[model samples]
Target: MERRTKQREVIWRTIQQAGRPLGPQEVLKLAQQRLPNLGIATVYRTLKAFLEDRRIVVVEVPGHTPKYELADLKHHHHFVCRKCDRTFDVNDCPRGIKNMAPPGFVVEEHYVALKGICPDCRNHGAGD
Candidate 1:
């Protein structure tokens, strides 16, 4: 039991440190640095538990497999730099939480994502 608990902690800390969202395979690489023998199943289960407890949330990438990130931190959306593939915090105005949900569904929060070339990329492109 203690072994499993330690593995879960490592996984959680890995996700927390990732800052941006990460998929299971990515989490496995980080957690393995601490617990090399950690099973992939354990990481998956731990993330699922965290999601169920609202300790983390899902970040869908359209056609890509969804990624997971730590919840309970400051709420902000992600902007993906198309040119550099960097993720940034938009920190846009907060609103439309309740208004975006469907009937009988309550939205306590939301994360808006914008994908485009960031300022750095744009500047680099100008040089090119």
Candidate 2:
């Protein structure tokens, strides 16, 4: 079993409290508020260890740096706001995605990142 440290606990808690996925820099910035000495190296190392131990999962959206979230979260897709560059979880997926693959291809897993203006940005006219 991995021995937990204060830094690891703080890092994990930051991700949990974020409510959505976050990239390494974002994680490091928030974690440092709790443990001021937190370093990028430690953040990366801890994230790597968490992934190896299956404690957390990676969120990948094309053209963006990968984010991380708790492994226990239910399966879901993601949506990216093109205007403000924020990403949000998308709970439901289109039903026929698997069938879109070519014949004879067994689709075991899939990831989708929808891009559009988020409500906040739209209301604020962020990109206008």
Candidate 3:
């Protein structure tokens, strides 16, 4: 049982509106526009509470910092732009991914992240 504070609300709403996973710094930066007094400590603490309550889930891309997004979002994958270092949500997933696993291995869960030049970066001539 946790009381929802203005900071928490702002943080949650910021993440919800971002439409993609955000790191702690991104959340704090966006939340501060609404609450100038928002602190990094408060952002981290509230994120912890949110995780404990299952209000948010973590998005992990190998070799990158973890990100956070709303828990109720539908299943999806992610793509990272190597040029801009930005991550984007990829709604489409390949079928029969579970069959790729080795024998005797029960595939319970999976996360897919593709790395390439995103459209924005490609448009900017940052990548091929």
Candidate 3: misplaced stretches above 4 Å? 1-4, 125-128
TM-score, candidate 3, is 0.84
lDDT of each: 0.79, 0.87, 0.86
- The local distance difference test score of model 2 is 0.87
**Two-way lDDT contest, 1 vs 3, winner:** 3
Candidate 2, residue 82: Cα displacement in angstroms equals: 3.5
lDDT of 3 by residue, 72-126 (tens): 9998999877776667899998899999999999998888898888887877873
Candidate 1 lDDT tens digits, 95-121: 666776779997766656788788888
- Candidate 1 residue pairs in clash (backbone atoms < 3 Å): none
Q: Model 2, 9-127: lDDT tens per residue?
A: 89989999998888899899898898888899999999999999998999877776788988999889888877756678989988999999999999999878898888998899844
- Sort the candidates on TM-score, descending order: 3, 2, 1
Q: What TM-score does each of the candidates earn? A: 0.67, 0.80, 0.84
RMSDs, each prediction? Answer: 5.1, 3.1, 3.2
How many collisions per candidate?
Answer: 0, 0, 0
Report residue 108 deviation for candidate 1 (angstroms).
Answer: 8.6
